[model samples]
Target: MTTVFRKALGALPRLGVQVLDLGPGAAVVSRRGGYTATKMSGDSWMVGGKRPRTRTTADGWGLHKAAAGDLCARHVADLLANYEVNCVFDVGANKGQYGRQLRELGYRGRIVSFEPVPDALARLRKSAERDPEWRVYPFALGRSESFEDMHLGWKTMNSLLQPSAYGQRRYKRFTDTRKEQVRIRRLDEVMDEALEGIAEPRPYLKMDTQGFDMEVFAGAGRRTADFVGMQSEVAVLQLYEGSPRMNEAIAAYEDAGFAITGMYPVTREKTTGRVVEFDCVMARAAAAPSRQG
Candidate 1:
């Protein structure tokens, strides 16, 4: 039924709802008003009546172009299947869109969502209101419980754990409207409780914690072994400053006994050049007994 639903959704007529500028970032629009879509446009277009810029869409969803950094809608579904995901850690969840995308992809397993922005968190909670398994965590994910200065942008751009926030600090200048001391928690801090709280025997992690991908795993510690795979939104450019942050992530997984199997470019190829951004890192868990052996 879900497959049929997805197909039906896929079969519906699509539009060239390209992603437009949210001033500093991108957003998706339905040229047909948030319904089904077909061939997306190759050029940049505006949404919410804003000016257009370079944009792209996911492979399947045809629902206009979206600027979700490296993590696109197609990647969202791909991660759901690729990881054989049971439980997901939707870190840096903005308005529960990541979780919604996964659910829309027929991911029926548990979803543990976390978001930091108070307003965004509220919307995230409201989005998850009907679902029981989709647990929306309201807090900032980071290296620790320290007061990490997070820049909250509008829409999906609201992130302290993403490259955009870091970029907002580095490249762009903005005056922060609301700043609060959010409780920054590590993954390891809530693993036992979180895992016990969900349905899966062992859950996979889908981390899009802004640019703080590495530190979340670091916080995961030894319990990181419990995950089957990971799809993280890594900040390869800003955080690593042009070095391979993906390789660094692989090393972290290796240290934790996981292997980096596949990588997905987070950009929509239909747009433009090598200036592509984002990668969904898929790491498979090492055999437990063999690791001990």
Candidate 2:
């Protein structure tokens, strides 16, 4: 149903129709050819043409290209609100872009960002200096505590893992142009220390650590239960050496009591229309009922 609606909505602009929002879940569509479509209800529409006696439900009519981003942003904002998330762990935060986006989307909660790269950390600190609620850390999270060589890419594509040959071939920008030694620590070991003294810490975790998401999750260990929701970047293709594939990432989250709620494509190959990576939003899975005595 969503696919059908998306296809129909995608064809609207080409047909000279402009979609105008009337209110929540309703819209007024005007065509350049002097026709107007006013949504009366989810299941009813009024056409400006000859008063046709038949009326049909306009269920999925208002979705448009320009509104997709807004829809996603609102969806995430609602999730944060629903869970009453007080703190967001912005893992693999490079230049605090994810944190900034969350703030732009109206999330007023506290944000703790972790970035290990020297230059990137500097920029992240600068960007977050004005926001007292947004804190920046100078370390990376992984399966264990140690120092590791980070592969630096053209811009924000740096990762602890080496890029696969296919990754370099598909996107030259992901090529490991240089290396930086960064401090890495296990999230479980430092979770309490990092989030110390929070009165009500309902943490929402968001990770964009290139292809090292699974390791981060593993490092979270029992601390995963403390989070109400999490979002991580998962690969559809093998972009980095030893990176978990989409299914593997999903299974890991499931094992940690999380259920996949949403997925948004982050990168795609233009030629093949294949998704390279996507961000998966997960929430704590509901527990099954106990057996009757």
Candidate 3:
């Protein structure tokens, strides 16, 4: 990328243009107006435009969502309102970032966060001290109850599965191999306890367990339908051993009767400029209220 081109790209975000992909001689950009601009090569740009519509907002949530240019947040806000999400079960709630983001989006519902790592749990607890609606749990949710070793990577990259060679090579932080034996519990087993004090719980489940999302879903078992909506980190490229690919994860959600609402790229491979993983949001199709004539 040339300096002039880089500078221009930097300024595009202010205009609501998000650079989704950039390669050796090509680029893919999208806008809130539902248009995609792709550069084939040598200044040949193909523009795919949708019917323009005004984006008007009166609330703090809409303002934050529009200003941040986060499609995931906007989608989550939509689902919460549509599905009447009164409680959120934040699986893999590392250091309460997701919870904090929820509050920023003006969500005032109950937030129950689960984190197994001692260091992360400590920080997550401290951050929720001022918020009475936010609660924390100190165990990981998985397919079954057992003491399993968790790969403790740098910051929020912790995982239950071992990191692959490609993962370590592509992301240097994954090279860390510190292991901690953490308690793994099934969400179904503790679902009642988690919802004990909450009244009329309409839940949304969000999982970011570093490739362990499938296991967490499995742990939820038959109670998965209790959640009106869910969000998971689906991987296009396998980063951890035994982690299901994007297709498999999406299939699981679909089989469970959820319809995909949105997918926003979370990370990209630097060399290939391909999406490594994305936040996939899905809602139970049957949960939507029928429209009256």
Candidate 4:
């Protein structure tokens, strides 16, 4: 019945519906109008018609509640504030979602967003047009400059790495990849220009390039020190083939002189109830202390 319902939803155009599993005996249907209905263990449905109101933090991941926006956005904002971040490089900015969230969270820094997906980049540019502080770039960031085929996943889950078998089995959308050739540039080559005109440029790097975050990080080279803080979406379970696991990614960041400020679960697997990914925020160890200290 679930499979049939999902197929029916897919058949409909512009339905804007997504079915997400929240562990055993729990499922959530999210609709276009910001409505959500959750199926509980005993076949009871908990429905909310309006958009979800999210606070900064909860006891855990808040899985029982309606899908909250990025659980770590506020944390990122806080880190930005703490480090006096004056500019931000929003790598993999999909339609300016993260930039908007940062603004709502009271961050007034300059946002330089990079996106390679044509459709998404168009929307991202439009979103940033009214806000002079927000800038949009039209190429993907990677370890080197070149063109690569990006596999588009569900929503903004597109990546250079192929989705793994586990990802396809857990999320049906992984099977529907539409590849697009995109230009990739190294951050080291563009960093100075991106930061141009920003006074006392204390930068923050926010990356959500699905599984290619490390590559983006590598692109920064020794200039990683230029950032006061950074955020990366690391996989707890390898969703994309060749993507680094959580531990490896964390270690890499630590080795690069960044220390974890906070770690927030992004999503969990249905069957095993394991965290699938995390929005891990880190800051340069030498600069992580709070102003109040």
Query: Which candidate leads in lDDT?
Result: 3
lDDT of 3 by residue, 122-233 (tens): 9999989999999899999999999999988667889999887778888788866699999999999988987887778889999999999999999999999798889999
Question: Each candidate's TM vs. the true structure?
Answer: 0.64, 0.74, 0.75, 0.77
Q: Is candidate 2 or candidate 3 better by TM-score?
A: 3
- Candidate 3: Cα lDDT at 277: 84
CA deviation > 4 Å runs, candidate 3: 1-69, 291-293
RMSD of 3: 12.2
Best of the two (3, 4) by lDDT: 3
lDDT of 1 by residue, 1-293 (tens): 44554444454445444332232233343454532222223333323333235433333222222444323555545555655566888877878887887777578887888887788889999989999888887786656767666655545554453344435454343334344566788888887766674455657777766456777777777777778767776444553232236556667667776665555555433423332345555555443224333
**Model 1 Cα RMSD, 1 decimal:** 10.0
Worst 10 residues of 2 by lDDT: 57-66
lDDT: which is higher, 2 or 3? 3
CA displacement after TM-score superposition, residue 209 of candidate 4 (Å): 0.5
Per-candidate Cα lDDT values, in order, are: 0.60, 0.77, 0.82, 0.81
The regions of model 4 sitting more than 4 angstroms off are 1-71, 288-291
Clashing pairs in 1: 14-37, 14-38, 17-64, 70-266, 70-278, 161-209, 161-210, 161-211, 162-210, 162-211
Candidate 2 stretches with Cα past 4 Å from truth are 1-71, 286-293
Q: Could you tell me the TM-score of candidate 1?
A: 0.64
What tens digits encode model 4's per-residue C-alpha lDDT throughout 32-103?
A: 545555553233445655544663343234643223334366567777888888999999999998898888
